[model samples]
Target: MPYYENAIKKMLPKTYLRQHVAHEIYVALTHFQSLVPMMDKYVYNDGTMKNLMSLTGTIPVMFEDNTYNIPVCLWIEESYPQTAPICYVRPTCEMTVLSGKYISSNGEVMLPYLEEWKNGECDLVSLLQVMVVVFGDFPPVYMHSHPEPEQAPCWLQFHRQAEVLSRTDGSLYLHLASEDDLPFQQENETSC
Candidate 1:
């Protein structure tokens, strides 16, 4: 049997919902075969499969009936090697933006970020290590942030105001000011 058919069979004892999900996965896989390989050495590795199975054991396996509930679906696009597997988080769930940046439910931005990290010569082990480090804790405040002005109205006036703000106890302001430092480091640490 195909992977989707197998998935559907496995999910038959669970709930009708999972069957639908399995079908969808199967359809996506079939339709996008040219885009994604049948097997991924990195994502489908034994370790990775184990991790996914672990997640299935704990996390809510059934898709909740709610506007804010996002269905976690996996898809592979042509960008897999250059990018990351496209993990679709259904838009039903409300995603909170930590600062002010907005990430879509389709995982567009995440793909690029993954690509950059991977293409930067980071090996799969190192990539997984970084992923564990970054995603394990999953700081709530690191999701999204507010967008800043594009032109800043005027550079000179903006800098003057920025300088004044920097002089005072503007930690909150500073924290929201830049996307680079939104995480707010302690004692000038590089790692978040």
Candidate 2:
């Protein structure tokens, strides 16, 4: 009937004394929070007693042939550091497979970056960057079938993924020249 969440994060093995040994879970969660501050924090039956991985927003992948706004999930276990948090790529029905054996239909990703994670020595950010980069190297294929051709967004929307944009806080949109062919420029406003 009520809800409570753990203040810290850790992807460690299931054990009895996990609560007593909280490490970079807090740091990792907070760090991810800082990067995706606007994204909603998801809790999977999360409670102070039973902490689960938190999910944020979609990591939009604009491949040359297709587009994928891959939703990401982060979870800390009882055996963290020695075992890195598993990264799940939640794909939508719109996505179609292209290539990559590590990826699965259940959204499970067997990435080498996570496989080679060294606790205390590695950070989640670096792992995330690696995942994104690897995704670029072996991206999944998406169907080009548009349900509503007239209602589709501009072509630029399907090609707006960048390292710079990924680091910036808040939501961003791809604004291209419309029929009027006006130059893309921000107004005098100080905020996005």
Candidate 3:
């Protein structure tokens, strides 16, 4: 076996990183085969993935614990590699960062930052770090009143429901609300 295989096998048995649903899916897709090829094609080619992995490393894993510990579901699709991954966080968990935010199917936040990054406003690494920090304290409710319907650009509307997931327990999950779904309204009500 190659070095990466040995490393992954050892990492799998030792850390909570392997618990991520994405990892399982990746493993299943690879079927014990070398992921370096896929990684080279799908992950490495995408500048965002390189930045993400550089920041979080190969595992790119997170964990949440409460009454019951559960893995956050996150997946990556190549067709939309330019966009962030879709993620889903358990609703029952106390981490509210991702609970109400609209996310893409691949669990990436549809923020203007990505557009700015693409425009050369910043590099991928800085963009990724900024995303991590911004989402780290993300609010449970997204206040849509700020953007006027007529003034909102097509891209904004297109990705309106996309949001990055961040867990208080240091895990992250991405989720996207359906476009047809009614927009979220902010109320004084709080989840108990």
Candidate 4:
């Protein structure tokens, strides 16, 4: 708790316009312990870079019959509450981003809640809840299919043998020619 308080407090100086920013962040962190506060450089599509406070972690998304932790990064600008925060689905190496109505190919997330964010009405906690619900309906990522393990090629040699079945004792026997003892010839098969 102390760590969170210190981190959130240090995120913005006291002179920052929003005085409730730290408290809102603290409450959000309290509810969502999976998220951790950090300061990182955010690069815009226009190549503009700015140091911003972001929460990087996974949000629980219920998909199918199981729950998946979808990695995400939420960047809160200094004018937060007044402006909507930028959110992105940060998929892991084992996951691939799924582009849809709510998520872009680059993993950017767009939700009605975010688009209609109201300073007094909206907060981080509810934003996460909305994300969870939206993501559950339309998953933002899918697990990458790992290649199957290499298997040793099985070489089976088929020989043309004559089988004799005796009706007297119901006995079966096979007879093969001497030429059948030679190794099998490799087939010239080609794949495009």
Candidate 4: segments with Cα more than 4 A from true spot: 1-3, 148-192
**Candidate 1: which stretches are off by over 4 Å?**
1-74, 94-113, 117-132, 136-192
Reference-based lDDT, each prediction = 0.34, 0.52, 0.36, 0.79
Enumerate residue pairs that collide in model 4.
none
Highest-scoring model, lDDT: 4
Quality of model 4 by C-alpha lDDT:
0.79
Which tens-of-lDDT digit does each residue in 1-192 have in candidate 3?
545444544443232233342343344334322122122222432555531211112212122321222223223333223444433332222223344343453334555665443422333334434444444444222223344545645455566565555657766555455455553443422222
User: How many steric overlaps are in each model, in order?
Assistant: 12, 10, 13, 0
Estimate the TM-score of every prediction.
0.24, 0.48, 0.26, 0.72
Q: Write the per-residue lDDT of candidate 4 for residues 1-192, one digit (tens) a residue.
A: 467675677777554443477777788888778998888999999999988878899988898878999999999888887988899999876688999999999999999999999999999999999999999999999985763345221232233443343444665433333333543332321112
Tell how far residue 161 is off in model 4, in angstroms.
Answer: 56
Quote the RMSD, in angstroms, for model 2: 15.7
List the candidate numbers ranked by TM-score, top first: 4, 2, 3, 1
In candidate 3, which residue ranges exceed 4 Å CA deviation? 5-74, 80-83, 87-92, 95-108, 115-128, 140-192
How far in Å is the alpha carbon of 7 misplaced in model 1?
Answer: 8.7
